[model samples]
Target: MLKGLAGLKAAAAKPNSFARHGVATVLVTAATMALGLLTGILVARSIGPEGRGALTSVLTTVQMLGWLFAMGCGKAVTYTLSRDHSAGGRLLSTWTLILLPLAGLAIGTGYLLLPLLLAAQPPETLELARLYLPMIAMALLSELMLGLILGDQDFRSFNALNFLQPAGVAVVYVALWAAGRFTVEAAVIVQAAMSTLVLAAATALLIRRHGLARPDPALGRKSLWYALRTHGDVVGGVITQRLDLLIIPAVLSAKQVGLYALATSLSWLIVSLSSALATVVMPAATRRGRSGRELVLNSLQATFAIGGLLGGGLFVFADIAISLVYGPSFADSALPLRLLLPGAVLYAAAAILLNGLYAENRPFTATLANLLGMAVTLGGLILFLNSGGILAAAIVSTVAYTLVFAAAATLYRHATGLPWRVFLPDPALLAALPRRLLTKPSPVAAAPANPAGK
Candidate 1:
């Protein structure tokens, strides 16, 4: 069995088309996950439940604001730059210029609102929220840098920075705690410092490698418009994903909101795994025509299988995992985690399907699916929040994602003229693929080469 597994591994690494890039991405993802787990443990140990809850609330708010400012341009940067390198470079510069002022405005807005929003909270927690708001804003620069690296397909640099940023923040926080300088305010300061350093380094590297000497203003404008259209799904999708977080705080008590936040954090692991696969397959998917259908089907199959396995494991171990990482103070979160687990798995599969639509330039379809999903989620949450508390929130969120996934699969079939049946996962078919993987040598042929190769 050991020799067979070794042989299978060798076969998997034969440098065939997407497989080569996929293998590399898997390595990067593995490293990122490892570092992220360590960072999570450190944060849990250092700050405990209250700190974790505060960080979750602040980060969720920041994520929504950052998504709004970027306008989904980050994903668009990758797709656009991959299609036209020179044009992409100019667009990247333009986007950076546009985002700088926007980031400032967002930071100012968040800072101004912090006191008003947290006025009712405990004095210490309110103070912590205010201290963290600026750090969230500072991280926007790092996010922009990430967009540029992804646009250029510099996954090596991107992944390195990905691991570094979180790990750096964790290490700084731990060091500060060890030295008796750790406070919620100090943690925010450390976060700001790390974001500044990473953003500067990433921006400098990307500019040195891919920056246009004199970017054409006309080209930049055109690329910006095109990117907006191309990335509409991403913009809508972010709003849809974040709706519960954004609204829950308004409707629920701080403690209830905190429970929902904890559940959402657990769900994020599903997304992280899905994102790893999507990052690997996106470039390849863009190069195909009819063959993209088969690629999407195959990807969904793998994603669903993996997501199901992991989600199930998480569900089974939810209480233990929550207690271990977050301590017994957060035991209230276990049931919410279980409620969201299946939905999280479905959300993961949906993400890959949405990526497929984006590759096919069917952003309209993707956007529609996301909007519909958001409607379902919000409507359900409103109806249930009054009757049932955090559990209702989890159930509604799961239902929303399931609907979204179904919608995406339906739209993908309609757009590509692919049969709806193709969306369904067939365990028999997947079981049959291993023999083909071994005997055929190549799992799939290479996507046609594009001149840009951004």
Candidate 2:
């Protein structure tokens, strides 16, 4: 047992920067997920199916709007900063200033439409929506701050905030529930408060650590144009990725929506692992410049291996896992979970490629691919849902993600004219794995060699 334990640690300690970052990200994500699972259980027990479903709907709406307000600036920031530290810092400040009003506008619009939107819902759901919509504005503000931190590769801070935001909201919700102030409206209000507080703290820390210098007007204008173009692609990608949730609710019952939400939350375990790897790889790939092909290949190989392993494990244990995390009430989620497993794998592959595209500053292609996938998904859903229901939705999502991955792979190949197979791991590469092998150190390394490197 000790030998096995030691071997596991040794494997974990292997000289791979990506592995180290993946490990960190996994730890953080796992912590956050654990907290989320606990919170879900608590909310489920306290709020029952209807309340949880309403909360899910409200949260989803907030997320979609939040993405619009932030406009992919977080990723843009990460890609930019990874290349030019000074410009990145300046851009971060400028983005924050510009996005604040947009956040306010999004929230204002939600507030104004809340009454009409709720009037169209059941009385219970309407009340929840009314309470929930207003708080989303605060969450939007935090998202903008998140973009700043991500651009700077401040994962430690970013992860800290990520963990704190959800965990803190859970704690507040539990406290309120215990004190008999646990209305869904109150929960949303508390969530907004926690989100705003965390964003303020994170932004303050970023300014202090990175300085508050604003971008020059000319540089800011250039960066804005770059951001606008890149962000459009990101928005399209997000829509492609998240469109199912929007469509599922409209075409299916609330129960079906709840079931789908449960499956998606479970699938997030796999996607989160993939996202963690992409998060670490994106900055490194950006730093590699024109010579990023090797880095991109290695990153994809590692991501596929890790993501495949994690996703497969989830697939194997789908039933028991879903039962435990979400309760037997969500047993219907298991089939969808199993069906979505392969899609999760493809999603990870697409993510790695997307990062490479971002690093290459060819976000336009990535965006175009995403738009194509979105069209495919929407068309598939429209056709399939009429005949097949929720199952159709799952199939459409899987097919759409597969299309996105293939498109991204093709684009990467054409842009760099590199052999596409190099990005894919050969069976021989996996089969001939040596117990002992010498590997070249990554040129960029993980951390800067000196404090002044950045």
**TM-score, predicted candidate 1 vs. hidden true structure:** 0.83
Superposed on all Cα atoms, the candidates' RMSDs to the truth, in angstroms, are 6.5, 7.6
Best by lDDT: 2
Local error of candidate 1 at residue 424 (angstroms): 3.8
- Global CA lDDT computed for model 1: 0.66
- 1-454, model 2: which lDDT tens digit per residue? 5764563344334425444555677688878887777777777667765566666766777777677666666666676676677675577567767777787788877666555533323566655665665555565556656766766666678778878888898888788778877766776777778777897898788777678776567756765666676776677676777777766655566677777877777776777766565776567666544444455666566567767888888889888976776678778888887777788788777887877777767767667778878888879887888688767778888787788888888887666666545665745534432221113333322222121100
User: Which regions of candidate 1 fall more than 4 Å away from where they truly are?
Assistant: 1-17, 111-120, 123-143, 230-232, 251-255, 288-292, 426-454
Q: On a 0 to 1 TM-score scale, where does candidate 2 land against the true structure?
A: 0.83
Instruction: Score each candidate by Cα lDDT.
Output: 0.66, 0.68
Ten contiguous residues minimizing lDDT sum, candidate 2: 445-454
* Number of clashing pairs per prediction, in order: 0, 3
